[model samples]
Target: MTPHVPALPAMGVVALLRALLKRPRRPLPSALPEIVTEYRLDRLPLDDIARYRAAFGFPGEHIPLTWWYLPAQRAHLAT
Candidate 1:
């Protein structure tokens, strides 16, 4: 006959909490990731004002609030 293995008991909330409290937390890295990429039109993919206007749902004769950002995040990651 094959030997039977006993199932492990489930940990209670207090036990779980104690285990978590005993566990060591890793320290965060000193250097922070650069998020503030410079707002430049040259970095954008828009060829002309018309294209820029079209990208922002065709806002009539005015730039939309959301237009003031990098079109793609590739530039930010590059730095």
Candidate 2:
């Protein structure tokens, strides 16, 4: 069963919108990198996944494909 989660307050939404609007945008590279960048995970982050699922109301039976974005974003920032 999905747990009940509180909705975001109106001020919280306004704050998020303000932050996003004020953030600077980055430009994409003119040319693609000669070598492909790949990210590998030696082990799954089960605890983190569990927390993510609970927060997002995803079922715990399996890992959702969307969870991959977490690692991908981290890898992008690291490089």
Candidate 3:
């Protein structure tokens, strides 16, 4: 059977927060034309835009967002 691991140490939390805080805040990418077009999006299908949006969780979106942090957390937990 696999052994259970404890939660992150206080230092680990602080370090992660520090690293995240240190990252520069930049504008979101503009490659997503549907989300940034200046004119009406009548030509763009809503389903396509929805699909792209579904790929990432927005601030107010109900979709799960923890996967973004899973890799780093897993690495730290492994150590």
Candidate 4:
């Protein structure tokens, strides 16, 4: 069985703006295979980190390991 989660209460216009302001900004993590590629797992040796940064212009540290998902997909397709 799945667990139930509570939803946030509706906020008034002013309150909604305030809530949004208070919310923290989090950088999105890169896809899974990108992470694996960046770390050079297994024998693939794909340069995910460099490619992602070049394509999206993300700062070095903010790049998430998730980016490896692309390479993983390609590997699966090849098989």
Give one clash count per candidate, in the order shown.
Answer: 0, 0, 0, 14
Off by over 4 Å in 1: 1-49, 71-79
Against the hidden reference, what TM-scores do the models get? 0.33, 0.48, 0.20, 0.31
1 or 4, greater by TM-score? 1
> lDDT for every model?
0.66, 0.84, 0.55, 0.67
Our model 3 lands, by Cα RMSD against the true structure, at 15.7
What ranges in model 2 sit over 4 Å off? 1-38
Task: Please provide, for model 4 over 1-79, each residue's C-alpha lDDT reduced to its tens digit, 9 standing for 90 to 100.
Answer: 9899899887789987897789558866666554342334565444657677678776665555667677678777765
Runs off by more than 4 Å, candidate 4 = 1-40, 43-48
RMSD of each: 11.1, 11.6, 15.7, 17.5
Q: Give the distance in Å from residue 7's predicted Cα in candidate 1 to where it truly belongs.
A: 24
**On residues 1-79, what C-alpha lDDT tens digit does candidate 1 reach at each position?**
9899998999999999998889558878899887675645554344555577886667676655555544446565666
TM-score of 4: 0.31
lDDT of 3 by residue, 1-79 (tens): 9899998756678788998789657878868655432323245344544554566644443433454354456555755
By summed lDDT, the worst window of 10 consecutive residues in model 3 runs over: 35-44
Model 2, 38-65: lDDT tens digits are 7779899888898889889997568978
Best by lDDT: 2
The worst-scoring run of ten residues by lDDT in candidate 4 lies at 32-41
Instruction: Point to the candidate with the largest TM-score.
Output: 2
